[model samples]
Target: MNFKGLFRHFTDMKHYFVVVLVVFAISFYLGWANSDRYSFFLEGQLQGLKSVSQSLSAKGNPQIWYFIFIFLNNAVKSVLIIFLGLFFGVLPLYMLVANGMILGYVLSLQTNESTLSVVLKGILPHGIIEIPVILIACAYGLKVGMLVWKMGGQLFLPVERRTARRELANVFRLSKTLIVAIVALLLLAAIIESTLTYWLVHL
Candidate 1:
Protein backbone atom coordinates (compact mmCIF):
# COMPACT_ATOMS: atom_id res chain seq x y z
CA MET A 1 0.00 0.00 0.00
CA ASN A 2 1.21 3.47 -0.77
CA PHE A 3 0.87 4.96 2.68
CA LYS A 4 2.28 8.25 1.49
CA GLY A 5 -0.15 8.40 -1.38
CA LEU A 6 -2.96 7.47 0.95
CA PHE A 7 -1.99 10.10 3.48
CA ARG A 8 -1.62 12.76 0.83
CA HIS A 9 -5.00 11.93 -0.65
CA PHE A 10 -6.72 11.87 2.74
CA THR A 11 -5.11 15.12 3.72
CA ASP A 12 -6.65 16.70 0.69
CA MET A 13 -10.00 15.56 2.03
CA LYS A 14 -10.34 18.71 4.10
CA HIS A 15 -10.98 20.63 0.92
CA TYR A 16 -13.86 18.33 -0.06
CA PHE A 17 -16.12 19.05 2.88
CA VAL A 18 -16.77 22.58 1.80
CA VAL A 19 -19.93 20.94 0.56
CA VAL A 20 -20.66 19.48 3.98
CA LEU A 21 -20.26 22.84 5.58
CA VAL A 22 -22.61 24.26 3.02
CA VAL A 23 -25.07 21.51 3.77
CA PHE A 24 -25.07 22.38 7.46
CA ALA A 25 -25.63 25.97 6.53
CA ILE A 26 -28.63 25.04 4.46
CA SER A 27 -29.95 22.52 6.93
CA PHE A 28 -29.64 25.05 9.66
CA TYR A 29 -31.56 27.54 7.61
CA LEU A 30 -34.27 24.99 6.87
CA GLY A 31 -36.69 23.54 9.40
CA TRP A 32 -35.05 20.13 9.35
CA ALA A 33 -32.14 21.51 11.28
CA ASN A 34 -32.16 21.73 15.06
CA SER A 35 -29.81 21.02 17.93
CA ASP A 36 -32.43 18.67 19.33
CA ARG A 37 -32.50 16.42 16.29
CA TYR A 38 -29.96 14.22 17.98
CA SER A 39 -31.90 14.16 21.21
CA PHE A 40 -35.19 13.63 19.41
CA PHE A 41 -33.81 10.83 17.27
CA LEU A 42 -32.30 9.13 20.28
CA GLU A 43 -35.36 9.70 22.32
CA GLY A 44 -37.60 8.00 19.80
CA GLN A 45 -35.48 4.87 20.06
CA LEU A 46 -35.38 4.80 23.84
CA GLN A 47 -39.07 4.70 24.59
CA GLY A 48 -38.87 1.30 26.17
CA LEU A 49 -35.73 2.04 28.14
CA LYS A 50 -37.78 4.26 30.43
CA SER A 51 -39.12 1.07 31.94
CA VAL A 52 -35.76 0.57 33.58
CA SER A 53 -35.79 3.84 35.50
CA GLN A 54 -39.24 5.33 35.76
CA SER A 55 -38.26 8.29 37.92
CA LEU A 56 -35.11 9.32 36.10
CA SER A 57 -36.36 7.59 32.96
CA ALA A 58 -34.10 5.56 30.79
CA LYS A 59 -35.62 4.73 27.39
CA GLY A 60 -35.83 1.77 25.06
CA ASN A 61 -34.39 -1.72 25.31
CA PRO A 62 -30.68 -1.46 25.78
CA GLN A 63 -29.74 -4.20 23.34
CA ILE A 64 -32.12 -3.15 20.56
CA TRP A 65 -31.14 0.45 20.87
CA TYR A 66 -27.51 -0.49 20.55
CA PHE A 67 -28.09 -2.39 17.34
CA ILE A 68 -30.33 0.25 15.85
CA PHE A 69 -28.03 3.12 16.69
CA ILE A 70 -24.91 1.47 15.35
CA PHE A 71 -26.70 0.32 12.24
CA LEU A 72 -27.89 3.83 11.45
CA ASN A 73 -24.46 5.30 12.13
CA ASN A 74 -22.66 3.04 9.68
CA ALA A 75 -25.41 3.16 7.11
CA VAL A 76 -25.10 6.93 6.95
CA LYS A 77 -21.33 6.63 6.92
CA SER A 78 -21.45 4.28 3.94
CA VAL A 79 -23.78 6.59 2.05
CA LEU A 80 -21.46 9.50 2.74
CA ILE A 81 -18.54 7.48 1.41
CA ILE A 82 -20.34 6.62 -1.80
CA PHE A 83 -21.53 10.20 -2.20
CA LEU A 84 -18.02 11.58 -1.83
CA GLY A 85 -16.62 9.09 -4.31
CA LEU A 86 -19.28 9.63 -6.95
CA PHE A 87 -19.46 13.36 -6.57
CA PHE A 88 -15.68 13.68 -6.42
CA GLY A 89 -13.90 17.01 -6.01
CA VAL A 90 -14.44 17.65 -2.35
CA LEU A 91 -18.21 17.38 -2.42
CA PRO A 92 -17.84 13.97 -0.80
CA LEU A 93 -15.42 15.14 1.82
CA TYR A 94 -17.52 18.18 2.58
CA MET A 95 -20.57 16.06 3.17
CA LEU A 96 -18.68 13.88 5.62
CA VAL A 97 -17.09 16.78 7.44
CA ALA A 98 -20.34 18.68 7.61
CA ASN A 99 -21.71 15.68 9.40
CA GLY A 100 -18.99 16.00 12.00
CA MET A 101 -19.71 19.66 12.45
CA ILE A 102 -23.40 18.98 12.88
CA LEU A 103 -22.58 16.41 15.52
CA GLY A 104 -20.34 18.80 17.38
CA TYR A 105 -22.87 21.57 17.16
CA VAL A 106 -25.72 19.40 18.34
CA LEU A 107 -23.79 17.87 21.18
CA SER A 108 -22.68 21.24 22.36
CA LEU A 109 -26.31 22.35 22.52
CA GLN A 110 -27.34 19.52 24.78
CA THR A 111 -28.49 20.88 28.13
CA ASN A 112 -29.27 17.55 29.76
CA GLU A 113 -27.21 16.20 32.62
CA SER A 114 -27.23 12.80 30.89
CA THR A 115 -25.80 14.21 27.70
CA LEU A 116 -22.46 12.60 28.42
CA SER A 117 -24.10 9.25 28.93
CA VAL A 118 -25.86 9.52 25.59
CA VAL A 119 -22.60 10.27 23.86
CA LEU A 120 -20.45 7.72 25.64
CA LYS A 121 -22.81 4.78 25.57
CA GLY A 122 -24.63 5.54 22.35
CA ILE A 123 -22.34 7.42 20.01
CA LEU A 124 -18.71 6.73 20.92
CA PRO A 125 -18.98 2.98 20.73
CA HIS A 126 -19.63 2.84 16.99
CA GLY A 127 -18.07 6.21 16.18
CA ILE A 128 -14.68 4.58 16.59
CA ILE A 129 -15.34 2.64 13.37
CA GLU A 130 -17.75 5.09 11.79
CA ILE A 131 -15.46 8.11 11.88
CA PRO A 132 -12.48 6.24 10.40
CA VAL A 133 -14.66 4.94 7.59
CA ILE A 134 -15.63 8.50 6.69
CA LEU A 135 -12.00 9.59 6.75
CA ILE A 136 -10.86 6.81 4.41
CA ALA A 137 -13.62 7.49 1.94
CA CYS A 138 -12.76 11.15 2.07
CA ALA A 139 -9.17 10.23 1.28
CA TYR A 140 -10.22 8.45 -1.89
CA GLY A 141 -12.63 11.22 -2.72
CA LEU A 142 -9.87 13.81 -2.42
CA LYS A 143 -7.67 11.97 -4.87
CA VAL A 144 -10.48 11.62 -7.40
CA GLY A 145 -11.52 15.24 -6.91
CA MET A 146 -7.99 16.48 -7.46
CA LEU A 147 -7.61 14.31 -10.51
CA VAL A 148 -10.84 15.65 -11.92
CA TRP A 149 -9.84 19.24 -11.25
CA LYS A 150 -6.41 18.71 -12.77
CA MET A 151 -7.65 16.70 -15.72
CA GLY A 152 -11.17 18.09 -15.97
CA GLY A 153 -12.83 16.74 -19.14
CA GLN A 154 -9.51 15.89 -20.76
CA LEU A 155 -10.00 12.32 -19.73
CA PHE A 156 -12.87 12.25 -22.21
CA LEU A 157 -10.79 13.62 -25.10
CA PRO A 158 -7.35 12.46 -26.14
CA VAL A 159 -4.31 13.89 -27.94
CA GLU A 160 -5.60 12.07 -31.01
CA ARG A 161 -8.37 9.60 -31.96
CA ARG A 162 -6.31 6.61 -31.00
CA THR A 163 -5.38 8.32 -27.76
CA ALA A 164 -9.05 9.00 -27.10
CA ARG A 165 -9.82 5.32 -27.07
CA ARG A 166 -6.85 4.67 -24.82
CA GLU A 167 -7.90 7.47 -22.48
CA LEU A 168 -11.45 6.14 -22.17
CA ALA A 169 -10.03 2.72 -21.38
CA ASN A 170 -7.92 4.20 -18.65
CA VAL A 171 -10.87 6.11 -17.27
CA PHE A 172 -12.90 2.94 -17.09
CA ARG A 173 -10.18 1.23 -15.12
CA LEU A 174 -9.87 4.06 -12.63
CA SER A 175 -13.62 4.31 -12.20
CA LYS A 176 -14.11 0.61 -11.58
CA THR A 177 -11.29 0.29 -9.05
CA LEU A 178 -12.29 3.40 -7.15
CA ILE A 179 -15.95 2.45 -6.91
CA VAL A 180 -15.19 -1.07 -5.73
CA ALA A 181 -12.70 0.06 -3.12
CA ILE A 182 -15.00 2.71 -1.72
CA VAL A 183 -17.92 0.31 -1.47
CA ALA A 184 -15.79 -2.35 0.18
CA LEU A 185 -14.56 0.03 2.82
CA LEU A 186 -18.08 1.22 3.48
CA LEU A 187 -19.28 -2.36 3.85
CA LEU A 188 -16.52 -3.20 6.26
CA ALA A 189 -17.40 -0.23 8.41
CA ALA A 190 -21.05 -1.24 8.42
CA ILE A 191 -20.18 -4.75 9.55
CA ILE A 192 -17.90 -3.65 12.33
CA GLU A 193 -20.49 -1.14 13.41
CA SER A 194 -23.18 -3.79 13.56
CA THR A 195 -21.24 -6.45 15.42
CA LEU A 196 -18.50 -4.84 17.43
CA THR A 197 -20.32 -1.63 18.30
CA TYR A 198 -23.39 -3.47 19.51
CA TRP A 199 -21.60 -5.99 21.67
CA LEU A 200 -19.19 -3.49 23.13
CA VAL A 201 -21.82 -0.95 24.03
CA HIS A 202 -24.39 -3.36 25.33
CA LEU A 203 -21.86 -5.26 27.38
Candidate 2:
Protein backbone atom coordinates (compact mmCIF):
# COMPACT_ATOMS: atom_id res chain seq x y z
CA MET A 1 0.00 0.00 0.00
CA ASN A 2 2.90 2.35 0.79
CA PHE A 3 6.02 3.16 -1.25
CA LYS A 4 8.25 3.06 1.81
CA GLY A 5 7.05 -0.41 2.72
CA LEU A 6 7.70 -1.61 -0.81
CA PHE A 7 11.13 -0.07 -0.88
CA ARG A 8 11.93 -1.54 2.49
CA HIS A 9 10.90 -4.99 1.33
CA PHE A 10 12.99 -4.68 -1.84
CA THR A 11 16.06 -3.38 -0.02
CA ASP A 12 15.78 -5.89 2.78
CA MET A 13 16.27 -8.52 0.09
CA LYS A 14 19.53 -7.46 -1.43
CA HIS A 15 21.44 -10.64 -0.67
CA TYR A 16 20.76 -11.90 -4.16
CA PHE A 17 22.65 -9.07 -5.86
CA VAL A 18 25.58 -11.35 -6.65
CA VAL A 19 23.37 -13.86 -8.38
CA VAL A 20 21.57 -11.12 -10.31
CA LEU A 21 24.83 -9.66 -11.51
CA VAL A 22 26.14 -13.00 -12.65
CA VAL A 23 23.00 -13.80 -14.59
CA PHE A 24 22.69 -10.36 -16.18
CA ALA A 25 26.35 -10.30 -17.14
CA ILE A 26 26.18 -13.65 -18.79
CA SER A 27 22.97 -12.89 -20.62
CA PHE A 28 24.26 -9.53 -21.78
CA TYR A 29 27.58 -10.89 -22.98
CA LEU A 30 25.98 -13.70 -24.91
CA GLY A 31 23.26 -11.55 -26.41
CA TRP A 32 25.61 -8.78 -27.40
CA ALA A 33 28.62 -10.88 -28.33
CA ASN A 34 26.98 -12.68 -31.22
CA SER A 35 23.87 -10.91 -32.37
CA ASP A 36 23.89 -13.02 -35.50
CA ARG A 37 23.07 -16.15 -33.61
CA TYR A 38 20.22 -14.26 -31.97
CA SER A 39 18.90 -13.34 -35.40
CA PHE A 40 19.20 -16.92 -36.47
CA PHE A 41 17.09 -17.97 -33.52
CA LEU A 42 14.38 -15.58 -34.66
CA GLU A 43 14.78 -16.71 -38.23
CA GLY A 44 14.37 -20.28 -37.20
CA GLN A 45 11.10 -19.42 -35.54
CA LEU A 46 10.03 -17.67 -38.72
CA GLN A 47 10.98 -20.68 -40.74
CA GLY A 48 8.79 -22.81 -38.55
CA LEU A 49 5.97 -20.39 -39.16
CA LYS A 50 6.64 -20.49 -42.85
CA SER A 51 6.34 -24.24 -42.81
CA VAL A 52 3.07 -24.08 -40.92
CA SER A 53 1.45 -21.75 -43.38
CA GLN A 54 -1.44 -24.08 -43.88
CA SER A 55 -3.78 -21.65 -42.15
CA LEU A 56 -4.51 -18.02 -42.96
CA SER A 57 -4.30 -17.15 -39.28
CA ALA A 58 -0.57 -16.43 -39.46
CA LYS A 59 -1.41 -13.46 -41.64
CA GLY A 60 -4.13 -12.26 -39.38
CA ASN A 61 -3.98 -9.76 -36.51
CA PRO A 62 -1.41 -11.16 -34.11
CA GLN A 63 -2.96 -9.28 -31.25
CA ILE A 64 -4.94 -12.43 -30.57
CA TRP A 65 -1.93 -14.48 -29.48
CA TYR A 66 -0.48 -11.62 -27.46
CA PHE A 67 -1.41 -12.72 -23.98
CA ILE A 68 -0.91 -16.41 -24.64
CA PHE A 69 2.61 -16.01 -25.96
CA ILE A 70 3.74 -13.47 -23.38
CA PHE A 71 2.31 -15.55 -20.58
CA LEU A 72 4.35 -18.52 -21.70
CA ASN A 73 7.53 -16.49 -22.11
CA ASN A 74 7.17 -14.86 -18.70
CA ALA A 75 6.42 -18.24 -17.16
CA VAL A 76 9.58 -19.71 -18.59
CA LYS A 77 11.65 -16.76 -17.40
CA SER A 78 10.10 -16.99 -13.96
CA VAL A 79 11.06 -20.63 -13.82
CA LEU A 80 14.64 -19.70 -14.61
CA ILE A 81 14.60 -17.05 -11.92
CA ILE A 82 13.17 -19.43 -9.32
CA PHE A 83 15.57 -22.17 -10.37
CA LEU A 84 18.49 -19.84 -9.93
CA GLY A 85 17.30 -18.90 -6.47
CA LEU A 86 17.03 -22.51 -5.39
CA PHE A 87 20.70 -23.16 -6.18
CA PHE A 88 21.93 -19.78 -4.96
CA GLY A 89 25.48 -20.84 -4.26
CA VAL A 90 28.04 -21.59 -6.96
CA LEU A 91 25.63 -23.86 -8.75
CA PRO A 92 23.06 -21.12 -9.28
CA LEU A 93 25.63 -18.75 -10.69
CA TYR A 94 26.91 -21.44 -13.01
CA MET A 95 23.44 -22.19 -14.27
CA LEU A 96 22.48 -18.54 -14.59
CA VAL A 97 25.66 -17.65 -16.42
CA ALA A 98 25.21 -20.57 -18.73
CA ASN A 99 21.76 -19.28 -19.57
CA GLY A 100 23.20 -15.88 -20.47
CA MET A 101 25.73 -17.57 -22.70
CA ILE A 102 23.07 -19.57 -24.42
CA LEU A 103 20.85 -16.54 -24.93
CA GLY A 104 23.72 -14.51 -26.33
CA TYR A 105 24.72 -17.30 -28.63
CA VAL A 106 21.18 -17.82 -29.80
CA LEU A 107 20.27 -14.18 -30.37
CA SER A 108 23.52 -13.65 -32.28
CA LEU A 109 21.76 -14.56 -35.51
CA GLN A 110 20.14 -11.16 -35.83
CA THR A 111 22.29 -9.27 -38.29
CA ASN A 112 22.34 -5.75 -37.00
CA GLU A 113 25.48 -3.88 -37.96
CA SER A 114 25.05 -1.36 -35.19
CA THR A 115 25.16 -2.54 -31.61
CA LEU A 116 22.89 0.27 -30.51
CA SER A 117 20.33 -0.68 -33.13
CA VAL A 118 20.33 -4.24 -31.96
CA VAL A 119 19.79 -3.27 -28.37
CA LEU A 120 17.33 -0.54 -29.16
CA LYS A 121 15.44 -2.40 -31.84
CA GLY A 122 15.52 -5.81 -30.28
CA ILE A 123 16.06 -5.92 -26.52
CA LEU A 124 16.00 -2.59 -24.73
CA PRO A 125 12.33 -1.93 -25.27
CA HIS A 126 10.88 -4.49 -22.93
CA GLY A 127 14.05 -5.44 -21.14
CA ILE A 128 13.90 -1.95 -19.68
CA ILE A 129 11.46 -3.13 -17.02
CA GLU A 130 11.25 -6.89 -17.14
CA ILE A 131 14.88 -7.72 -16.52
CA PRO A 132 15.16 -5.60 -13.39
CA VAL A 133 11.92 -6.98 -12.02
CA ILE A 134 13.14 -10.50 -12.55
CA LEU A 135 16.35 -9.73 -10.71
CA ILE A 136 14.47 -8.10 -7.85
CA ALA A 137 12.25 -11.13 -7.38
CA CYS A 138 15.15 -13.51 -7.54
CA ALA A 139 17.00 -11.38 -5.02
CA TYR A 140 14.07 -11.66 -2.68
CA GLY A 141 14.05 -15.39 -3.02
CA LEU A 142 17.75 -15.57 -2.26
CA LYS A 143 17.28 -13.28 0.72
CA VAL A 144 14.53 -15.43 2.16
CA GLY A 145 16.64 -18.55 1.87
CA MET A 146 19.60 -16.81 3.46
CA LEU A 147 17.45 -15.47 6.24
CA VAL A 148 16.06 -18.90 6.92
CA TRP A 149 19.52 -20.36 7.01
CA LYS A 150 20.89 -17.65 9.26
CA MET A 151 18.02 -18.07 11.68
CA GLY A 152 18.75 -21.75 12.02
CA GLY A 153 15.60 -22.82 10.16
CA GLN A 154 13.39 -20.92 12.59
CA LEU A 155 12.21 -17.83 10.75
CA PHE A 156 9.16 -17.52 12.94
CA LEU A 157 9.51 -18.62 16.53
CA PRO A 158 11.85 -19.45 19.38
CA VAL A 159 13.78 -22.68 19.04
CA GLU A 160 12.80 -23.69 22.56
CA ARG A 161 9.87 -26.09 22.87
CA ARG A 162 8.00 -24.19 25.56
CA THR A 163 6.51 -21.44 23.37
CA ALA A 164 2.94 -20.83 22.24
CA ARG A 165 2.02 -21.44 18.59
CA ARG A 166 2.75 -17.99 17.26
CA GLU A 167 2.31 -16.80 13.72
CA LEU A 168 4.93 -15.73 11.24
CA ALA A 169 2.50 -14.52 8.62
CA ASN A 170 4.71 -11.64 7.58
CA VAL A 171 7.29 -13.71 5.74
CA PHE A 172 4.71 -15.36 3.54
CA ARG A 173 2.99 -12.07 2.81
CA LEU A 174 6.19 -10.39 1.71
CA SER A 175 7.19 -13.32 -0.46
CA LYS A 176 3.81 -13.40 -2.16
CA THR A 177 3.80 -9.66 -2.78
CA LEU A 178 7.31 -9.69 -4.18
CA ILE A 179 6.57 -12.62 -6.43
CA VAL A 180 3.38 -11.06 -7.77
CA ALA A 181 5.09 -7.79 -8.57
CA ILE A 182 7.90 -9.56 -10.37
CA VAL A 183 5.48 -11.56 -12.43
CA ALA A 184 3.59 -8.43 -13.38
CA LEU A 185 6.71 -6.77 -14.67
CA LEU A 186 7.85 -9.85 -16.53
CA LEU A 187 4.52 -10.22 -18.25
CA LEU A 188 4.59 -6.55 -19.06
CA ALA A 189 7.93 -6.97 -20.80
CA ALA A 190 6.89 -10.11 -22.57
CA ILE A 191 3.75 -8.47 -23.87
CA ILE A 192 5.64 -5.45 -25.13
CA GLU A 193 8.33 -7.58 -26.73
CA SER A 194 5.82 -9.84 -28.35
CA THR A 195 3.05 -7.48 -29.42
CA LEU A 196 4.80 -4.19 -30.16
CA THR A 197 8.05 -5.63 -31.42
CA TYR A 198 6.30 -8.23 -33.42
CA TRP A 199 4.19 -5.52 -35.02
CA LEU A 200 7.11 -3.22 -35.75
CA VAL A 201 9.41 -5.91 -37.05
CA HIS A 202 6.81 -7.39 -39.38
CA LEU A 203 6.36 -3.93 -40.81
Candidate 3:
Protein backbone atom coordinates (compact mmCIF):
# COMPACT_ATOMS: atom_id res chain seq x y z
CA MET A 1 0.00 0.00 0.00
CA ASN A 2 1.78 3.09 -1.21
CA PHE A 3 5.17 1.52 -0.64
CA LYS A 4 6.95 4.31 -2.50
CA GLY A 5 5.32 6.94 -0.34
CA LEU A 6 6.32 5.08 2.78
CA PHE A 7 9.91 4.82 1.59
CA ARG A 8 10.05 8.53 0.83
CA HIS A 9 8.54 9.40 4.20
CA PHE A 10 11.12 7.27 5.96
CA THR A 11 13.89 8.87 3.96
CA ASP A 12 12.68 12.29 5.00
CA MET A 13 12.86 11.29 8.64
CA LYS A 14 16.22 9.60 8.47
CA HIS A 15 17.69 12.09 10.93
CA TYR A 16 15.13 11.16 13.54
CA PHE A 17 16.02 7.49 13.13
CA VAL A 18 19.66 8.39 13.52
CA VAL A 19 18.85 10.25 16.72
CA VAL A 20 17.04 7.24 18.11
CA LEU A 21 19.94 4.98 17.21
CA VAL A 22 22.43 7.25 18.91
CA VAL A 23 20.41 7.48 22.10
CA PHE A 24 19.99 3.73 22.26
CA ALA A 25 23.66 3.15 21.62
CA ILE A 26 24.65 5.52 24.41
CA SER A 27 22.21 3.93 26.83
CA PHE A 28 23.41 0.46 25.95
CA TYR A 29 27.01 1.44 26.48
CA LEU A 30 26.18 2.96 29.84
CA GLY A 31 24.34 -0.17 30.87
CA TRP A 32 27.23 -2.37 29.90
CA ALA A 33 29.89 -0.19 31.48
CA ASN A 34 27.95 0.30 34.71
CA SER A 35 26.57 -3.18 34.96
CA ASP A 36 28.03 -3.75 38.37
CA ARG A 37 26.66 -0.53 39.78
CA TYR A 38 23.21 -1.21 38.40
CA SER A 39 23.20 -4.92 39.09
CA PHE A 40 20.41 -4.84 41.67
CA PHE A 41 18.09 -2.78 39.51
CA LEU A 42 18.76 -4.79 36.40
CA GLU A 43 18.36 -8.04 38.32
CA GLY A 44 14.92 -7.01 39.49
CA GLN A 45 13.88 -6.22 35.95
CA LEU A 46 15.26 -9.53 34.68
CA GLN A 47 13.43 -11.40 37.41
CA GLY A 48 10.15 -9.86 36.30
CA LEU A 49 10.85 -10.92 32.74
CA LYS A 50 11.83 -14.39 33.96
CA SER A 51 8.57 -14.72 35.84
CA VAL A 52 6.62 -13.84 32.71
CA SER A 53 8.57 -16.37 30.69
CA GLN A 54 8.00 -19.07 33.29
CA SER A 55 4.28 -18.35 33.38
CA LEU A 56 4.09 -18.59 29.62
CA SER A 57 6.00 -21.87 29.64
CA ALA A 58 3.66 -23.27 32.26
CA LYS A 59 0.72 -22.88 29.87
CA GLY A 60 2.12 -25.79 27.81
CA ASN A 61 3.27 -25.72 24.16
CA PRO A 62 6.05 -23.49 25.25
CA GLN A 63 7.29 -22.50 21.80
CA ILE A 64 3.86 -21.46 20.60
CA TRP A 65 3.22 -19.63 23.81
CA TYR A 66 6.54 -17.86 23.60
CA PHE A 67 5.91 -16.77 20.02
CA ILE A 68 2.48 -15.44 20.82
CA PHE A 69 3.72 -13.68 23.91
CA ILE A 70 6.66 -12.07 22.19
CA PHE A 71 4.70 -11.03 19.13
CA LEU A 72 1.84 -9.48 21.06
CA ASN A 73 4.14 -7.85 23.57
CA ASN A 74 6.23 -6.15 20.90
CA ALA A 75 3.33 -5.32 18.62
CA VAL A 76 1.28 -3.66 21.31
CA LYS A 77 4.17 -1.66 22.69
CA SER A 78 5.43 -0.58 19.28
CA VAL A 79 1.98 0.64 18.23
CA LEU A 80 1.28 2.33 21.51
CA ILE A 81 4.51 4.25 21.47
CA ILE A 82 3.66 5.66 18.07
CA PHE A 83 0.56 7.41 19.40
CA LEU A 84 1.94 8.13 22.82
CA GLY A 85 4.76 9.98 21.10
CA LEU A 86 2.37 12.92 20.99
CA PHE A 87 3.75 13.74 24.39
CA PHE A 88 6.82 15.45 22.96
CA GLY A 89 8.41 12.08 22.15
CA VAL A 90 9.30 11.50 25.79
CA LEU A 91 7.71 8.07 26.08
CA PRO A 92 9.27 6.53 22.95
CA LEU A 93 12.70 7.91 23.80
CA TYR A 94 12.46 6.57 27.31
CA MET A 95 11.40 3.19 25.96
CA LEU A 96 14.40 3.09 23.61
CA VAL A 97 16.76 3.92 26.44
CA ALA A 98 15.22 1.39 28.78
CA ASN A 99 15.20 -1.46 26.28
CA GLY A 100 18.73 -0.75 25.12
CA MET A 101 19.97 -0.62 28.68
CA ILE A 102 18.26 -3.85 29.62
CA LEU A 103 19.69 -5.69 26.63
CA GLY A 104 23.18 -4.42 27.32
CA TYR A 105 22.95 -5.24 31.00
CA VAL A 106 21.80 -8.77 30.29
CA LEU A 107 24.61 -9.30 27.82
CA SER A 108 27.18 -7.94 30.23
CA LEU A 109 26.39 -10.59 32.80
CA GLN A 110 29.04 -13.29 33.07
CA THR A 111 28.11 -16.73 31.76
CA ASN A 112 29.72 -20.10 31.18
CA GLU A 113 29.87 -19.31 27.49
CA SER A 114 31.45 -16.45 25.61
CA THR A 115 29.46 -13.29 24.96
CA LEU A 116 30.08 -13.41 21.22
CA SER A 117 28.72 -16.94 21.05
CA VAL A 118 25.63 -15.95 23.00
CA VAL A 119 24.98 -12.97 20.72
CA LEU A 120 25.54 -14.90 17.52
CA LYS A 121 23.22 -17.69 18.54
CA GLY A 122 20.62 -16.09 20.80
CA ILE A 123 20.27 -12.47 19.63
CA LEU A 124 21.56 -12.05 16.11
CA PRO A 125 19.03 -14.39 14.57
CA HIS A 126 15.93 -12.37 15.47
CA GLY A 127 17.51 -9.11 16.50
CA ILE A 128 18.82 -8.46 13.02
CA ILE A 129 15.23 -7.78 12.03
CA GLU A 130 13.50 -6.99 15.30
CA ILE A 131 15.91 -4.32 16.48
CA PRO A 132 15.63 -2.31 13.25
CA VAL A 133 11.84 -2.55 13.30
CA ILE A 134 11.80 -1.24 16.83
CA LEU A 135 14.12 1.59 15.92
CA ILE A 136 12.01 2.57 12.91
CA ALA A 137 8.88 2.57 15.03
CA CYS A 138 10.58 4.84 17.52
CA ALA A 139 11.68 7.11 14.69
CA TYR A 140 8.12 7.47 13.48
CA GLY A 141 6.99 8.11 17.00
CA LEU A 142 9.63 10.78 17.37
CA LYS A 143 8.50 12.38 14.17
CA VAL A 144 4.95 12.52 15.49
CA GLY A 145 6.24 14.20 18.62
CA MET A 146 8.23 16.75 16.67
CA LEU A 147 5.28 17.51 14.44
CA VAL A 148 3.14 18.14 17.46
CA TRP A 149 5.78 20.46 18.78
CA LYS A 150 5.93 22.28 15.45
CA MET A 151 2.14 22.54 15.31
CA GLY A 152 2.18 24.23 18.69
CA GLY A 153 4.75 26.73 17.57
CA GLN A 154 2.92 27.45 14.34
CA LEU A 155 -0.38 28.14 15.99
CA PHE A 156 0.12 31.89 15.69
CA LEU A 157 1.32 31.77 12.10
CA PRO A 158 -1.54 30.87 9.78
CA VAL A 159 0.67 29.94 6.83
CA GLU A 160 3.04 27.81 8.87
CA ARG A 161 0.07 26.26 10.64
CA ARG A 162 -1.35 25.08 7.32
CA THR A 163 1.99 23.63 6.27
CA ALA A 164 2.47 21.81 9.55
CA ARG A 165 -1.05 20.41 9.41
CA ARG A 166 -0.50 19.09 5.90
CA GLU A 167 2.77 17.48 6.91
CA LEU A 168 1.11 15.87 9.92
CA ALA A 169 -1.63 14.43 7.73
CA ASN A 170 0.95 12.99 5.37
CA VAL A 171 2.74 11.43 8.36
CA PHE A 172 -0.44 9.72 9.52
CA ARG A 173 -1.07 8.36 6.05
CA LEU A 174 2.44 6.95 5.71
CA SER A 175 2.38 5.62 9.26
CA LYS A 176 -0.21 3.00 8.35
CA THR A 177 2.28 1.36 6.01
CA LEU A 178 5.08 1.61 8.56
CA ILE A 179 2.95 0.04 11.28
CA VAL A 180 2.03 -2.87 9.05
CA ALA A 181 5.65 -3.45 8.18
CA ILE A 182 6.66 -3.31 11.82
CA VAL A 183 4.00 -5.77 12.92
CA ALA A 184 4.78 -8.25 10.15
CA LEU A 185 8.53 -8.12 10.74
CA LEU A 186 8.09 -8.42 14.50
CA LEU A 187 5.91 -11.47 14.02
CA LEU A 188 8.62 -13.14 11.97
CA ALA A 189 11.21 -12.17 14.54
CA ALA A 190 9.08 -13.67 17.29
CA ILE A 191 8.85 -16.93 15.40
CA ILE A 192 12.59 -17.04 14.91
CA GLU A 193 13.27 -16.15 18.55
CA SER A 194 10.92 -18.80 19.86
CA THR A 195 12.14 -21.58 17.59
CA LEU A 196 15.54 -21.03 16.00
CA THR A 197 17.11 -18.82 18.64
CA TYR A 198 15.75 -20.94 21.44
CA TRP A 199 17.12 -24.12 19.88
CA LEU A 200 20.52 -22.59 19.20
CA VAL A 201 20.81 -21.12 22.68
CA HIS A 202 19.93 -24.41 24.30
CA LEU A 203 22.42 -26.26 22.13
**Deviating ranges (above 4 Å) for candidate 1:** 1-88, 114-116, 153-203
Candidate ranking under TM-score, highest first, comes to: 3, 2, 1
Instruction: Write down the lDDT of every candidate, Cα atoms only.
Output: 0.52, 0.56, 0.88
Per residue, candidate 3 scores C-alpha lDDT tens digits across 1-203 of: 77898987777988998899999999898788899887787788889899998898788788999999899999999988988889998899888988898899988884878889989998999999999999888888888888889888888886844576788888888778878888999999999999999899778
| Cα shift from native, residue 175, model 1 (Å) | 7.9
Q: Tell me which of candidates 1 and 2 scores higher on lDDT.
A: 2
Over 148-185, each residue of candidate 1 has an lDDT whose tens digit, in order, gives 55455565665563443453344334544544554565
By lDDT, the best candidate is 3
| Stretches of model 2 off by over 4 angstroms after superposition | 1-3, 30-60, 75-95, 147-171
Candidates sorted on lDDT, descending? 3, 2, 1
Each prediction's TM-score versus the true structure: 0.46, 0.63, 0.95
The 10-residue segment with the lowest total lDDT in model 2? 161-170
Model 2, position 59: C-alpha lDDT score? 50
